[model samples]
Target: MSELDHASDPVVGASSRRDLFKLAGAGVGLAAAAALPLVPATAFAATPRFRLGEPEPAFILDPDVLYMNIGTTGSTPKYILKQFNDDNREVATNPTQSFGGVTPFRTLAAPGFGAELEEFVISYNTTDGMNKILAGVELNSGDEIITTNHEHPGGNGPMNLLLQRRGVKITRVNLPVGNNQKAQDYVDLFKAAITNKTKAFVFSAPTYLTGTMLPYKRLAKLAQKNGIMTIVDGAHATGMFNLDFQQTGIDFWGCSGHKWQCGPGGTGVLYIRNRVTKANPLPLFNFWPTNTNNSTLIEPRTNANAETYNIGTAVQSIGNPNYPMLKAFAECCTFWDSIGRGVIEKHDLTLSLYLKQKIASVWSVDNLYSPKDDPELLSALTSFSPFHTSSASVALGQAATDETAQSTTFVTRMREEYGIVIRNTAVPVIGSPAPHHPMRISTHLFHSARDVDRLVRSMKDLASRMDAGA
Candidate 1:
């Protein structure tokens, strides 16, 4: 096949691997193709050029611990760490003034994420980004913001602040779980919930609890149809997905630089849609910079044709910023660009699917909180009930304090005995009194089928022993 042909091929294409996986996960007659191992050992041996675990050496993770908790945070790459140390040393030796704002860093990092220089801002992690986004947007009393019940505290905290301060009403949609759900189901739910008072759609792309990648583009389009705004908490998407701000159709996106991007802590990327596009052609909403020194200079875009002011520069020019950490964060984006975001996304999702399949084989599919059959809902994070046989346990009110204790013990023993670092989340089961605590695992570029297999085997054995009351 020619290079272009390879790029467009559904089965072996470099750019179409996600589509291929989507078809496979949806059971669209690619069963034999989906069963094949990822790269090198499969029919797609020659294509994609990137292999699973090829970037393992780039990270300085301890060999003893199988760290599968990228959903919470990620380990910085070795070269980036060295560069971060060097930059810090230089800054310490000579006092550096950041009068120009981090425009140069944003310039280097924005294109890789499909964002313009005027839209991308380097902030302090997802929480800071969420605060900036929520505080900047113009909202009034009685205006309603639609979001999901599975939101992390990062997004929830800011929305709560808006509620107390501005009297904005928060409406949360109860999210559905498991393999049976589709992306359209979420869109329909949100559409049904929207009222005349709805002002914005605030939601997480991949919710931290269940790892379901809510359809941001569809939701954004829905928001646009109602002349509202969309603010996405893309905490787990910045480094996990090949993101395009324009195509995503979101008005504001707050993401983490430390999670999947593996940059220094307290660093993040915030994108503000400064111009209108075909995807979201609604006039830009009125915004005021909350965490900026140049508030007087920044003006919200009023028309669809041009940007009135540099919103990124306004939000990024807070006081004397951490220059070294921001520089390292920019360098991390460059490194991800060098590796190709599509390649990383493919590897991460491939491992995630493999792990999901393994868990389904051993425990059946009913216990999973994360969706697997719908590829649009798939993310690098997978969450499942290790102790329960079915989600019906929730309806029976069985996910109680004892189950929470067992889940905590499972996490502790996974790290202590098996040397694997993973986390457990309290997933809210619809029609249940309390939330179900399930194990959540993150698959990234540093992992392979072998690592996934090891995780499955360890989890299976540990769950078996714990079930037998040993």
Candidate 2:
């Protein structure tokens, strides 16, 4: 469904659970789940005894359906939903008073991630954030961009646009797979791809496909050394990692709040380095506001720290912003802060590591597309082969993923039969002619060890069933 559908959702303004369910036929995503009945997805009761490193029941999800595909989107907790609903109604009552200007939100949000308010802005999503950064950059004809093959369309959309408009060349590094690869291998591939004409380095941190966490800090340093602009498609990294943007020395980064942050859809975070610091020595790139309320403006402003204009204001205050959505996103960030970002990241990674180890034990270590031992390459997403019979078939490369119906069939069955919601991503293996479609799962603060076990066991049973009597 579209954003318009969500905006018109009757359940979004529902005052009670009954009203929510009655209005619920909204869809399968988080926006719809808000109004759906709280059906327990697992056998575990929604008990009140809070334990250490366990999933919290702060949000109401359809218990009947086990949702593990958080990388796609997430279930917004009740507190955020309640605030969003209330704010929406309040805005309706007072339409003229524009609660714009993200300074307050930025101030509340930045410290948690070790950034300053001047460098942050609430964005529509990863796509919107990427658009903002790309629009600001003064790209020239014949300039080249370096990225990975694993990027989502959100990041690729802007790069592809640059390619079409400015005649800029685009190069992609075919990322390696499984436990054999290290963080250095990623840096090496990107370094080899860079040339004298390269103007920018952009890529997703933890790629959606194969869930590989590319070394961002090292890559950013590489870009800085080359005097090239860095744009990070950090869609899944925001809430999953305690990011120190300033420390990373990246020029720009964009992330989706709806995925791991558990914020509303159409909400995201964008970090743009505001001034020249020791972290980045290159002269500031001249940027003009594409969507701004200011009738008059300045250009090619100073990139130094003294009396600097808040670049965040120019980006954030463009047009009338969604006060409710932005407010909810701020609240979500606060929620993460209150719980401690470090604590949350630890829990998320721990769950993912557990699932990865379990998969290795059951399906063999080679089946994993995500790294296991190296903490640097790990993320909350775990991708692997569920086809027990054809697990070794991929060694022949393209034929395995191209011919196999296992990924599509297994994902469908998991949702329809097993009452679970997860996704499959196609990965471009080094020598493979066709992309290897691996089953992917996201472990978040809303899931538990039981949730992990259920997913693994259900996958095992279903894979056995689909194994053609192997």
Candidate 3:
């Protein structure tokens, strides 16, 4: 099918490359650009006056869909999309300068893109980047790394892989759900868990399940004291929150750009401190091992399996990355900076608090899993549970319940029956053993008070229907 036809088709979700290139082509041909159907594309370029009850920022995303689930995958604005297209076109037209030339495009990207190329910041998907950090580092057998129950399965699988393949030991530190425990309790627990055998410490900087911000500053100090290299699986920490990995003093960190950072898919960031340069031994691409005392020299000497985590030629030749998207993410950073961390934090909390209040007012709502309105603990995402319901009864088990299955049905019902696109978190719900909860929702810059109102209205309707046996 043609690109326009595909985009126009209700059955086909998200726009395609043909559509993206067509949009780019229009811009190149000034006459054609004016004719391309721009989806509220002008608002992005103009300075929007932030007014109460004003329509939320609509960034070339599908206006037909109420995408409250920015946490899952962010919607890139047209300005950024245009930049990506232009960059890609430039690469296609001038391969020598763009990819093969002395001034390679990727090299330009290294300065501002993410972690510097000289550093261990390799660009890959979330799991790919995490695997690089996990595989590159040396872990002595029987060394222990402390983690938590509240993590995505992507993270869980990797930790387990390390344990199964490398003889590393994982110590899970469980945090209390809801009001069961305070934030300091978690910090103390992690500190208490550390032992001489602890080589690395890993945890989600922000607890994925509850969006509870972990005390990284405090934890970093502790990790440093114990001489344990810290690897934080901060998939959700990037876009939704401001991060200064250097300031955090952690040895290594990995995060996805799509979640809150709103960068395109297959984009992520990894950071390794300069201190780890000499101390931390990383695997090499085409690594050759040597009997030399120097760790850096050992990679050249050891040649068994050096190609494991290298970006290699496979990723290097994929043309210049969606330059516009990278530019857009930089713009998103600019946008975040202008809004100020305090304001963004306040905006997210306002929506979450509003949702929490609405849910609390409902007769059937039982437990709200998000942090209790504390700015230090809260984030853009919230997960909650509905009590006195048939679905909840069937799903909740003594050990753990599959929040993914339950939330899928709820969110699907919300979207198909109503017009909402909330996310279902795969992070273990507070007080639950499993790594998923029945319902999870995300609020972003695009979401407005009205959207929250719509959610509140639908939730009340759902509760009433359930109560009435419908």
Best by TM-score: 1
Better of 1 and 2 by TM-score: 1
Candidate-wise lDDT, in order: 0.82, 0.75, 0.55
Candidate 1 regions with alpha-carbon error over 4 angstroms: 1-18, 22-51, 54-56, 97-101, 394-399
TM-score of each: 0.91, 0.85, 0.71
What lDDT score goes with residue 398 in model 1? 48
In model 3, what lDDT does residue 245 have?
58
1-470 per-residue lDDT for model 1 (tens digits): 11111233333324444474754454433342235434332323432433347444577788889999999998888878997888788778876744244778899899989899888998899999999999989988999999989998999998998899999999999998777799999999999999999999999989999899998888888888899899999999999999988778899999999999988999999999988888778998888888888848554476675677888888888788888888888988988786677767776777787778877778888878898877788899999987784355553344487788899999999999999999999888787777888899999877876787789899999999998997
Checking candidate 2 for backbone clashes, the offending pairs are: 39-63, 40-63, 41-63, 276-303
Q: How many Å off is the CA of 422 in candidate 3?
A: 1.0
| Candidate 3 per-residue lDDT over residues 366-449, each given as its tens digit | 466665434456556766765322123233564344444445667777788777787655544444334545466887655665
RMSD of 1: 4.1
- Model 2 lDDT at residue 195: 96
What would the per-residue lDDT of candidate 2 be over residues 252-322, giving only the tens digit for each residue? Answer: 98989898998999999888887777777666766666756766565556757542677777778777778
